[model samples]
Target chain A: QKEVEQDPGPLSVPEGAIVSLNCTYSNSAFQYFMWYRQYSRKGPELLMYTYSSGNKEDGRFTAQVDKSSKYISLFIRDSQPSDSATYLCAIGGTYKYIFGTGTRLKVLA
Target chain B: EAGVTQFPSHSVIEKGQTVTLRCDPISGHDNLYWYRRVMGKEIKFLLHFVKESKQDESGMPNNRFLAERTGGTYSTLKVQPAELEDSGVYFCASSQAPGSEETQYFGPGTRLLVL
Candidate 1:
Protein backbone atom coordinates (compact mmCIF):
# COMPACT_ATOMS: atom_id res chain seq x y z
CA GLN A 1 0.00 0.00 0.00
CA LYS A 2 1.12 3.59 -0.54
CA GLU A 3 2.50 5.16 2.60
CA VAL A 4 0.03 7.99 2.50
CA GLU A 5 -3.39 8.31 0.89
CA GLN A 6 -5.73 11.27 0.36
CA ASP A 7 -8.81 11.88 -1.73
CA PRO A 8 -8.03 13.90 -4.82
CA GLY A 9 -11.10 15.98 -4.24
CA PRO A 10 -12.26 18.81 -6.42
CA LEU A 11 -14.55 19.44 -3.48
CA SER A 12 -16.58 22.59 -3.97
CA VAL A 13 -18.22 24.51 -1.16
CA PRO A 14 -20.01 27.78 -0.83
CA GLU A 15 -18.40 30.71 0.85
CA GLY A 16 -18.76 30.73 4.65
CA ALA A 17 -19.10 26.96 4.66
CA ILE A 18 -16.95 24.58 6.59
CA VAL A 19 -14.31 22.60 4.73
CA SER A 20 -12.62 19.46 5.95
CA LEU A 21 -9.64 17.79 4.34
CA ASN A 22 -8.27 14.46 5.44
CA CYS A 23 -5.45 12.00 4.87
CA THR A 24 -4.54 8.52 6.08
CA TYR A 25 -1.14 6.97 6.54
CA SER A 26 0.12 3.44 7.06
CA ASN A 27 3.38 4.29 8.73
CA SER A 28 3.14 4.29 12.47
CA ALA A 29 6.58 5.81 12.72
CA PHE A 30 5.51 9.22 11.48
CA GLN A 31 5.46 11.75 14.27
CA TYR A 32 4.75 15.07 12.64
CA PHE A 33 1.75 15.96 10.49
CA MET A 34 1.44 19.03 8.29
CA TRP A 35 -1.04 20.64 5.93
CA TYR A 36 0.06 22.61 2.89
CA ARG A 37 -1.83 24.95 0.60
CA GLN A 38 -0.86 25.19 -3.06
CA TYR A 39 -2.25 27.64 -5.54
CA SER A 40 -2.11 27.22 -9.28
CA ARG A 41 1.50 27.56 -10.55
CA LYS A 42 2.87 28.06 -7.06
CA GLY A 43 4.67 25.78 -4.66
CA PRO A 44 3.10 24.14 -1.62
CA GLU A 45 3.01 26.52 1.33
CA LEU A 46 2.97 25.31 4.91
CA LEU A 47 -0.48 25.94 6.36
CA MET A 48 -0.79 23.98 9.58
CA TYR A 49 1.60 21.75 11.50
CA THR A 50 1.03 19.46 14.47
CA TYR A 51 3.21 17.08 16.42
CA SER A 52 1.94 13.74 17.62
CA SER A 53 -1.83 13.78 18.26
CA GLY A 54 -4.52 16.20 19.39
CA ASN A 55 -5.48 19.51 17.78
CA LYS A 56 -3.73 22.70 16.82
CA GLU A 57 -5.60 25.82 15.82
CA ASP A 58 -4.46 28.96 14.10
CA GLY A 59 -7.02 31.58 13.28
CA ARG A 60 -9.70 29.97 11.10
CA PHE A 61 -7.71 26.78 10.45
CA THR A 62 -7.47 23.75 12.67
CA ALA A 63 -5.36 20.61 12.32
CA GLN A 64 -6.14 17.34 14.03
CA VAL A 65 -4.17 14.14 14.25
CA ASP A 66 -5.17 10.73 15.55
CA LYS A 67 -2.09 8.58 15.83
CA SER A 68 -4.18 5.62 16.87
CA SER A 69 -6.02 5.65 13.58
CA LYS A 70 -3.17 7.12 11.58
CA TYR A 71 -5.53 9.80 10.38
CA ILE A 72 -5.04 13.55 10.03
CA SER A 73 -7.34 16.34 9.10
CA LEU A 74 -7.44 20.06 8.35
CA PHE A 75 -10.60 22.03 9.06
CA ILE A 76 -11.31 25.43 7.62
CA ARG A 77 -14.08 27.41 9.21
CA ASP A 78 -15.85 30.24 7.43
CA SER A 79 -14.20 29.29 4.17
CA GLN A 80 -13.64 32.01 1.62
CA PRO A 81 -12.82 32.14 -2.05
CA SER A 82 -9.30 32.94 -1.04
CA ASP A 83 -9.13 29.45 0.48
CA SER A 84 -9.66 27.90 -2.90
CA ALA A 85 -6.58 25.84 -3.53
CA THR A 86 -5.12 22.35 -3.29
CA TYR A 87 -4.67 20.95 0.18
CA LEU A 88 -1.86 18.48 0.82
CA CYS A 89 -1.24 16.36 3.86
CA ALA A 90 2.34 15.49 4.74
CA ILE A 91 3.66 12.93 7.18
CA GLY A 92 7.18 13.70 8.34
CA GLY A 93 9.85 11.37 9.59
CA THR A 94 13.33 12.20 10.73
CA TYR A 95 14.52 13.92 7.57
CA LYS A 96 11.94 13.36 4.87
CA TYR A 97 8.26 13.94 4.22
CA ILE A 98 5.73 11.75 2.47
CA PHE A 99 3.02 13.84 0.82
CA GLY A 100 -0.44 12.85 -0.32
CA THR A 101 -1.95 13.59 -3.71
CA GLY A 102 -3.46 16.94 -2.85
CA THR A 103 -7.21 17.61 -2.80
CA ARG A 104 -8.28 20.55 -4.98
CA LEU A 105 -10.87 22.78 -3.35
CA LYS A 106 -12.95 25.61 -4.76
CA VAL A 107 -14.98 27.98 -2.62
CA LEU A 108 -17.70 29.79 -4.48
CA ALA A 109 -18.55 33.40 -3.80
CA GLU B 1 13.98 37.24 4.94
CA ALA B 2 13.32 35.75 1.55
CA GLY B 3 11.77 32.30 1.12
CA VAL B 4 13.24 29.41 -0.81
CA THR B 5 13.76 30.17 -4.50
CA GLN B 6 14.02 27.82 -7.51
CA PHE B 7 15.34 28.81 -10.92
CA PRO B 8 13.99 28.24 -14.39
CA SER B 9 10.39 28.21 -13.20
CA HIS B 10 9.50 26.11 -16.20
CA SER B 11 11.43 23.94 -18.62
CA VAL B 12 10.55 21.76 -21.57
CA ILE B 13 13.09 19.23 -22.74
CA GLU B 14 13.17 16.48 -25.32
CA LYS B 15 13.50 12.89 -24.25
CA GLY B 16 17.12 11.72 -23.98
CA GLN B 17 18.22 15.32 -23.32
CA THR B 18 19.65 16.72 -20.13
CA VAL B 19 18.35 19.31 -17.69
CA THR B 20 19.54 20.77 -14.43
CA LEU B 21 17.33 22.33 -11.74
CA ARG B 22 18.63 24.69 -9.13
CA CYS B 23 17.42 25.72 -5.67
CA ASP B 24 18.60 28.38 -3.26
CA PRO B 25 17.38 27.72 0.24
CA ILE B 26 16.56 30.28 2.86
CA SER B 27 19.74 31.59 4.45
CA GLY B 28 21.05 29.67 7.45
CA HIS B 29 18.77 26.69 6.92
CA ASP B 30 20.79 23.55 7.56
CA ASN B 31 18.51 21.08 5.85
CA LEU B 32 17.51 20.97 2.18
CA TYR B 33 15.20 18.56 0.37
CA TRP B 34 14.22 17.66 -3.20
CA TYR B 35 10.79 16.32 -4.15
CA ARG B 36 9.01 15.49 -7.38
CA ARG B 37 5.38 15.09 -8.40
CA VAL B 38 4.59 13.26 -11.58
CA MET B 39 1.35 13.82 -13.45
CA GLY B 40 -1.60 12.77 -11.30
CA LYS B 41 0.69 11.34 -8.62
CA GLU B 42 1.48 12.33 -5.10
CA ILE B 43 4.56 14.34 -4.32
CA LYS B 44 7.47 12.09 -3.42
CA PHE B 45 10.72 12.76 -1.68
CA LEU B 46 13.93 12.45 -3.71
CA LEU B 47 16.68 13.31 -1.27
CA HIS B 48 17.83 15.40 1.65
CA PHE B 49 21.00 17.38 2.26
CA VAL B 50 22.49 18.65 5.45
CA LYS B 51 24.91 21.35 4.50
CA GLU B 52 27.30 19.98 1.84
CA SER B 53 26.59 16.41 2.85
CA LYS B 54 23.76 14.19 1.72
CA GLN B 55 21.96 13.02 4.81
CA ASP B 56 19.58 10.73 2.97
CA GLU B 57 19.09 9.90 -0.71
CA SER B 58 17.15 6.68 -0.50
CA GLY B 59 14.26 8.08 -2.52
CA MET B 60 16.25 8.83 -5.69
CA PRO B 61 14.71 6.90 -8.58
CA ASN B 62 17.88 5.63 -10.21
CA ASN B 63 21.48 6.28 -11.21
CA ARG B 64 20.48 8.67 -14.00
CA PHE B 65 19.55 11.24 -11.39
CA LEU B 66 22.25 13.20 -9.60
CA ALA B 67 22.05 15.90 -6.91
CA GLU B 68 24.76 18.03 -5.36
CA ARG B 69 25.11 20.75 -2.76
CA THR B 70 28.52 22.35 -2.88
CA GLY B 71 29.73 25.05 -0.44
CA GLY B 72 26.72 24.20 1.71
CA THR B 73 24.62 26.79 -0.09
CA TYR B 74 22.59 26.36 -3.24
CA SER B 75 21.91 22.86 -4.56
CA THR B 76 21.35 21.27 -7.96
CA LEU B 77 19.64 18.18 -9.34
CA LYS B 78 20.65 17.00 -12.80
CA VAL B 79 18.89 14.49 -14.96
CA GLN B 80 21.01 12.90 -17.66
CA PRO B 81 19.24 11.44 -20.67
CA ALA B 82 15.89 12.34 -19.25
CA GLU B 83 13.08 9.98 -20.02
CA LEU B 84 9.47 10.80 -20.82
CA GLU B 85 8.53 9.54 -17.40
CA ASP B 86 10.76 12.19 -15.88
CA SER B 87 8.30 14.93 -16.64
CA GLY B 88 7.02 16.36 -13.40
CA VAL B 89 7.09 19.30 -11.02
CA TYR B 90 10.28 19.46 -8.97
CA PHE B 91 10.03 21.17 -5.60
CA CYS B 92 12.81 22.29 -3.33
CA ALA B 93 12.34 22.80 0.39
CA SER B 94 14.48 23.87 3.31
CA SER B 95 14.10 23.67 7.04
CA GLN B 96 15.88 25.28 9.91
CA ALA B 97 16.97 21.89 11.25
CA PRO B 98 16.71 18.13 10.73
CA GLY B 99 13.96 17.42 13.21
CA SER B 100 10.58 16.15 12.11
CA GLU B 101 8.69 19.10 13.63
CA GLU B 102 10.68 21.83 11.93
CA THR B 103 8.65 23.72 9.33
CA GLN B 104 9.83 23.38 5.76
CA TYR B 105 9.59 26.29 3.35
CA PHE B 106 9.19 25.35 -0.29
CA GLY B 107 10.15 27.13 -3.47
CA PRO B 108 7.80 27.94 -6.34
CA GLY B 109 8.87 24.67 -7.98
CA THR B 110 10.25 23.94 -11.44
CA ARG B 111 7.68 22.59 -13.84
CA LEU B 112 9.46 20.20 -16.19
CA LEU B 113 7.99 18.72 -19.32
CA VAL B 114 9.95 15.91 -20.92
CA LEU B 115 8.67 15.58 -24.43
Candidate 2:
Protein backbone atom coordinates (compact mmCIF):
# COMPACT_ATOMS: atom_id res chain seq x y z
CA GLN A 1 0.00 0.00 0.00
CA LYS A 2 1.07 3.55 -0.59
CA GLU A 3 2.19 5.46 2.49
CA VAL A 4 -0.37 8.18 1.84
CA GLU A 5 -3.56 8.37 -0.23
CA GLN A 6 -5.81 11.30 -1.12
CA ASP A 7 -8.68 11.83 -3.48
CA PRO A 8 -7.65 13.69 -6.63
CA GLY A 9 -10.71 15.82 -6.44
CA PRO A 10 -11.61 18.75 -8.63
CA LEU A 11 -14.21 19.43 -6.01
CA SER A 12 -16.17 22.55 -6.83
CA VAL A 13 -18.02 24.62 -4.29
CA PRO A 14 -19.78 27.98 -4.26
CA GLU A 15 -18.48 30.95 -2.45
CA GLY A 16 -18.98 31.01 1.33
CA ALA A 17 -19.26 27.23 1.41
CA ILE A 18 -17.40 24.90 3.69
CA VAL A 19 -14.77 22.69 2.09
CA SER A 20 -13.14 19.60 3.47
CA LEU A 21 -10.11 17.76 2.11
CA ASN A 22 -8.94 14.43 3.46
CA CYS A 23 -6.12 11.92 3.23
CA THR A 24 -5.45 8.42 4.60
CA TYR A 25 -2.19 6.74 5.38
CA SER A 26 -0.92 3.23 5.91
CA ASN A 27 1.93 4.16 8.20
CA SER A 28 1.18 4.31 11.89
CA ALA A 29 4.54 5.90 12.51
CA PHE A 30 3.56 9.17 10.89
CA GLN A 31 2.98 11.86 13.49
CA TYR A 32 3.40 15.14 11.69
CA PHE A 33 0.53 16.00 9.35
CA MET A 34 0.62 19.00 7.05
CA TRP A 35 -1.62 20.66 4.48
CA TYR A 36 -0.21 22.58 1.53
CA ARG A 37 -1.79 24.79 -1.10
CA GLN A 38 -0.45 24.74 -4.65
CA TYR A 39 -1.52 26.99 -7.43
CA SER A 40 -1.00 26.22 -11.07
CA ARG A 41 2.67 26.35 -12.03
CA LYS A 42 3.76 27.05 -8.46
CA GLY A 43 5.22 24.96 -5.70
CA PRO A 44 3.36 23.64 -2.70
CA GLU A 45 3.02 26.20 0.06
CA LEU A 46 2.60 25.10 3.66
CA LEU A 47 -0.77 26.03 5.00
CA MET A 48 -1.30 24.38 8.35
CA TYR A 49 0.32 21.52 10.18
CA THR A 50 -0.51 19.49 13.26
CA TYR A 51 1.49 17.13 15.39
CA SER A 52 -0.12 13.88 16.55
CA SER A 53 -3.87 13.87 16.87
CA GLY A 54 -6.37 16.72 17.21
CA ASN A 55 -7.03 19.92 15.32
CA LYS A 56 -5.03 23.07 14.61
CA GLU A 57 -6.70 26.15 13.27
CA ASP A 58 -5.27 29.19 11.52
CA GLY A 59 -7.63 31.83 10.31
CA ARG A 60 -10.13 30.17 7.97
CA PHE A 61 -8.22 26.91 7.70
CA THR A 62 -8.26 23.99 10.12
CA ALA A 63 -6.23 20.78 10.07
CA GLN A 64 -7.23 17.62 11.90
CA VAL A 65 -5.42 14.38 12.46
CA ASP A 66 -6.57 11.04 13.86
CA LYS A 67 -3.64 8.82 14.62
CA SER A 68 -5.78 5.78 15.40
CA SER A 69 -7.48 5.90 12.05
CA LYS A 70 -4.41 7.19 10.27
CA TYR A 71 -6.48 9.84 8.63
CA ILE A 72 -5.97 13.58 8.27
CA SER A 73 -8.19 16.35 7.03
CA LEU A 74 -8.20 20.05 6.19
CA PHE A 75 -11.27 22.20 6.50
CA ILE A 76 -11.62 25.56 4.81
CA ARG A 77 -14.47 27.76 5.90
CA ASP A 78 -15.96 30.59 3.90
CA SER A 79 -14.33 29.40 0.77
CA GLN A 80 -13.45 31.98 -1.83
CA PRO A 81 -12.25 31.90 -5.41
CA SER A 82 -8.84 32.74 -4.08
CA ASP A 83 -8.87 29.36 -2.38
CA SER A 84 -9.07 27.62 -5.70
CA ALA A 85 -6.00 25.45 -5.92
CA THR A 86 -4.70 21.98 -5.20
CA TYR A 87 -4.55 20.78 -1.60
CA LEU A 88 -1.88 18.30 -0.64
CA CYS A 89 -1.56 16.29 2.56
CA ALA A 90 1.88 15.36 3.72
CA ILE A 91 3.04 12.89 6.36
CA GLY A 92 6.40 13.71 7.85
CA GLY A 93 8.72 10.95 8.88
CA THR A 94 12.19 11.11 10.41
CA TYR A 95 13.96 12.43 7.32
CA LYS A 96 11.53 12.72 4.44
CA TYR A 97 7.95 13.67 3.71
CA ILE A 98 5.42 11.45 1.97
CA PHE A 99 2.88 13.41 0.02
CA GLY A 100 -0.53 12.46 -1.29
CA THR A 101 -2.03 13.07 -4.72
CA GLY A 102 -3.44 16.55 -4.23
CA THR A 103 -7.11 17.37 -4.43
CA ARG A 104 -8.06 20.25 -6.73
CA LEU A 105 -10.52 22.73 -5.31
CA LYS A 106 -12.38 25.43 -7.24
CA VAL A 107 -14.52 27.94 -5.46
CA LEU A 108 -16.99 29.73 -7.66
CA ALA A 109 -17.72 33.39 -7.38
CA GLU B 1 13.96 37.37 3.77
CA ALA B 2 13.54 35.65 0.43
CA GLY B 3 11.95 32.22 0.06
CA VAL B 4 13.58 29.20 -1.56
CA THR B 5 14.46 29.75 -5.20
CA GLN B 6 14.99 27.35 -8.10
CA PHE B 7 16.71 28.05 -11.41
CA PRO B 8 15.55 27.34 -14.95
CA SER B 9 11.87 27.44 -13.99
CA HIS B 10 11.16 25.18 -16.96
CA SER B 11 13.26 22.89 -19.10
CA VAL B 12 12.57 20.59 -22.02
CA ILE B 13 15.23 18.17 -23.11
CA GLU B 14 15.64 15.05 -25.22
CA LYS B 15 15.26 11.70 -23.52
CA GLY B 16 18.97 10.85 -23.60
CA GLN B 17 20.22 14.35 -22.85
CA THR B 18 21.54 15.50 -19.51
CA VAL B 19 20.01 18.23 -17.35
CA THR B 20 20.91 19.81 -14.08
CA LEU B 21 18.51 21.59 -11.74
CA ARG B 22 19.60 23.97 -9.02
CA CYS B 23 18.09 24.98 -5.72
CA ASP B 24 19.07 27.78 -3.38
CA PRO B 25 17.55 27.30 0.05
CA ILE B 26 16.60 29.97 2.52
CA SER B 27 19.72 31.17 4.28
CA GLY B 28 20.83 29.33 7.42
CA HIS B 29 18.50 26.36 6.88
CA ASP B 30 20.43 23.25 7.78
CA ASN B 31 18.08 20.78 6.16
CA LEU B 32 17.51 20.64 2.39
CA TYR B 33 15.26 18.21 0.51
CA TRP B 34 14.62 17.21 -3.09
CA TYR B 35 11.25 15.96 -4.29
CA ARG B 36 9.75 15.07 -7.66
CA ARG B 37 6.21 14.76 -8.96
CA VAL B 38 5.49 12.91 -12.17
CA MET B 39 2.64 14.07 -14.35
CA GLY B 40 -0.17 12.42 -12.43
CA LYS B 41 1.54 11.12 -9.35
CA GLU B 42 2.06 12.52 -5.90
CA ILE B 43 5.19 14.42 -5.00
CA LYS B 44 7.83 11.90 -3.94
CA PHE B 45 10.92 12.52 -1.85
CA LEU B 46 14.24 12.17 -3.63
CA LEU B 47 16.75 12.88 -0.87
CA HIS B 48 17.67 15.03 2.09
CA PHE B 49 20.83 16.97 2.82
CA VAL B 50 21.98 18.31 6.14
CA LYS B 51 24.60 20.83 5.15
CA GLU B 52 27.05 19.21 2.73
CA SER B 53 26.20 15.73 3.96
CA LYS B 54 23.42 13.53 2.70
CA GLN B 55 21.25 12.56 5.62
CA ASP B 56 19.06 10.13 3.66
CA GLU B 57 18.75 9.21 0.01
CA SER B 58 16.50 6.20 0.16
CA GLY B 59 14.00 7.64 -2.25
CA MET B 60 16.34 8.20 -5.18
CA PRO B 61 15.04 6.19 -8.14
CA ASN B 62 18.32 5.07 -9.60
CA ASN B 63 22.04 5.69 -9.93
CA ARG B 64 21.50 7.88 -12.95
CA PHE B 65 20.28 10.68 -10.72
CA LEU B 66 22.82 12.52 -8.61
CA ALA B 67 22.40 15.34 -6.07
CA GLU B 68 24.97 17.47 -4.32
CA ARG B 69 25.09 20.26 -1.77
CA THR B 70 28.33 22.24 -1.59
CA GLY B 71 29.55 24.45 1.20
CA GLY B 72 26.24 23.86 2.97
CA THR B 73 24.66 26.30 0.55
CA TYR B 74 22.92 25.85 -2.80
CA SER B 75 22.29 22.31 -4.06
CA THR B 76 22.08 20.67 -7.46
CA LEU B 77 20.56 17.55 -8.98
CA LYS B 78 21.90 16.16 -12.22
CA VAL B 79 20.27 13.56 -14.38
CA GLN B 80 22.57 11.71 -16.76
CA PRO B 81 20.99 10.15 -19.85
CA ALA B 82 17.58 11.14 -18.70
CA GLU B 83 14.76 8.76 -19.42
CA LEU B 84 11.25 9.56 -20.57
CA GLU B 85 10.01 8.58 -17.16
CA ASP B 86 12.21 11.25 -15.61
CA SER B 87 9.88 14.01 -16.69
CA GLY B 88 8.47 15.71 -13.64
CA VAL B 89 8.40 18.81 -11.50
CA TYR B 90 11.35 18.89 -9.15
CA PHE B 91 10.79 20.73 -5.87
CA CYS B 92 13.33 21.80 -3.30
CA ALA B 93 12.50 22.48 0.31
CA SER B 94 14.43 23.63 3.33
CA SER B 95 13.82 23.62 7.04
CA GLN B 96 15.68 25.07 9.97
CA ALA B 97 16.02 21.73 11.69
CA PRO B 98 15.83 17.99 11.07
CA GLY B 99 12.79 17.18 13.16
CA SER B 100 9.36 16.49 11.75
CA GLU B 101 7.82 19.46 13.56
CA GLU B 102 9.89 22.00 11.65
CA THR B 103 8.13 23.75 8.81
CA GLN B 104 9.63 23.24 5.36
CA TYR B 105 9.58 26.13 2.96
CA PHE B 106 9.54 25.21 -0.74
CA GLY B 107 10.79 26.72 -3.95
CA PRO B 108 8.69 27.45 -7.02
CA GLY B 109 9.88 24.15 -8.51
CA THR B 110 11.51 23.36 -11.84
CA ARG B 111 9.26 21.78 -14.38
CA LEU B 112 11.13 19.28 -16.51
CA LEU B 113 9.94 17.62 -19.67
CA VAL B 114 11.97 14.82 -21.23
CA LEU B 115 10.88 14.21 -24.77
The clash count of every prediction, one per candidate, is 0, 0
Fraction of true interface contacts that also occur in model 1 = 0.93
lDDT of 2 at A77: 98
| TM-score for each predicted model, relative to the true structure | 0.98, 0.98
TM-score of 1: 0.98
Candidate 1 residue spans exceeding 4 A from truth = none
Highest lDDT: give the candidate number.
1
Model 1 lDDT at residue B27:
99
Error of 1 at B13 (Å): 1.0
lDDT of 1 by residue, A16-94 (tens): 9999999999999998899999999999999998886999999999999999999999999999999999999999978
Error of 1 at A3 (Å): 1.1
Task: Indicate the worst ten consecutive residues by lDDT in candidate 1 chain B.
Answer: B96-105
Residue A5 deviation, candidate 2, in Å?
Answer: 1.1
The residue-level lDDT of candidate 2 at B29 comes to 96
Query: Which residue pairs show backbone clashes in model 2?
Result: none
